[model samples]
Target: MAGGRIVVGVDGSAPSLKALKWAAGQAALTGDSLETVISWEYPASWATLMPGVPPEFDPERLAKQILKQAVDQALTPEVAATVTRTVVGGNAAQALIDQAKGASLLVVGDRGYSGFKAAVLGSVSSHVAQHAPCPVVVVRGETGDDEDA
Candidate 1:
């Protein structure tokens, strides 16, 4: 899909940064526009567990900052400038799935959780892979490497 949009989920994790890098490279090769997305939600029990949230504690703002930093770190200035950043409020997997509605590709990171933890909590990449409207790429491994696979 030439000149299509590539949607990628970034959460400031090492793996997500790697995914962002991979998505940017793919966009470069495909002549597609890159759109980086991040999502945030308040804990289910936040109102009961911590009744008084700080007035200045804004999860959405924090998410936006993380998204911006991830894109800046993962791509060059010229490329970063061309990228579209999106911040959404809701479940991460669902957010990506919704954002990827007509996208050429959806990319996310495999956080590499193992065994019991993975089975217990599941994962965003795993969920999106099964549910995204478009093809998905789950980037896995160390984050800082520049090698291409």
Candidate 2:
């Protein structure tokens, strides 16, 4: 196994699924523990303001659900067994950066939900690549080598 922890950010996107697979393979090869993180924000509500609204809503449960579903759909049973999941609030880029502080490598998808229609990389992925403490890998969609030529 590898000597350091491998952390991957997953957001249920196709690129994220690819990144998860890649991270799993790396973890398996290096014998490093894998930490799968999924960050979520509560949906904004336009309903009448309640007098007793909580300071911060717990998106952890929702993040967990999404992460679990993504993992179940993307990985084989054996590969999925090796991952550990975490959920946090705030921006996805910041969350991944925080997680990267203790990790050997951070993996993310090239594009996710936070992208303009013609964007090459998602905002979070681009930000994390520029600022993460650990090495970052951005998984891109699979395409023939000649496609970009």
Candidate 3:
């Protein structure tokens, strides 16, 4: 967390991309720096079955790649240029909460890449909304009735 920062959680989902666009628009207007965070976790179950960490398996690198891809997809070149990328190995909610402690706001999608698509709020977004130190914005897509699904 840092002063004058706005944090947004991204997972490459459509909602997340929409959220990123929304957040970027806000950042441009408010002059606050945007930090795009994408969290990841390697399953603990893999530890028991694997002899050693694979040379080809780099979770952090993969996380950054995902973050980069999401940013490229969601934002215009001007918007994406001003953003700072953060990749962490842990729970997305907790990471977002911590990142928001010194932020002006926390923005997330209505849902993410996970099961329970019908749920109004995905687990990560729900947790961040309830616990973030700053005010939270959950961006949902669709500008009008016909566009909503």
lDDT of 1 by residue, 49-128 (tens): 66788878998999899888888888999999999999999988899999999999999888732223546343888899
Q: What's the number of clashes in each of the models?
A: 0, 4, 0
> Tens digit of lDDT per residue, candidate 2, span 1-149?
35789999998888898899898888888888889988876435413434455757445776788899989988898878767888888778899999889798999988776434376457888899999998999888766773531
Candidate 3 Cα lDDT to native = 0.84
Off by over 4 Å in 1: 48-52, 112-122, 143-149
For model 3, which pairs clash?
Answer: none
The estimated TM-scores of all candidates read: 0.86, 0.79, 0.83
lDDT of 3 by residue, 4-119 (tens): 78899998888888888889988877888999999887666767656587769987888898899999988888888879999888878898898788899899997887533566
**Candidate 3 displacement at residue 14 in angstroms:** 0.8
What is the TM-score (0 to 1) of candidate 2? 0.79
Residue 136 displacement in candidate 2 (angstroms): 0.6
Error of 1 at 40 (Å): 0.3
TM-score, model 3 to reference: 0.83
Give me the candidate number with maximum lDDT: 1
Residue 44 accuracy (lDDT) in model 3: 62
Over 4 Å off, model 2: 43-59, 115-121, 143-149
What 10-residue stretch in candidate 3 is worst by lDDT?
113-122
Q: Tell me the deviation in Å of residue 145 in model 3.
A: 3.7
* Model 1 lDDT-worst window of ten: 112-121
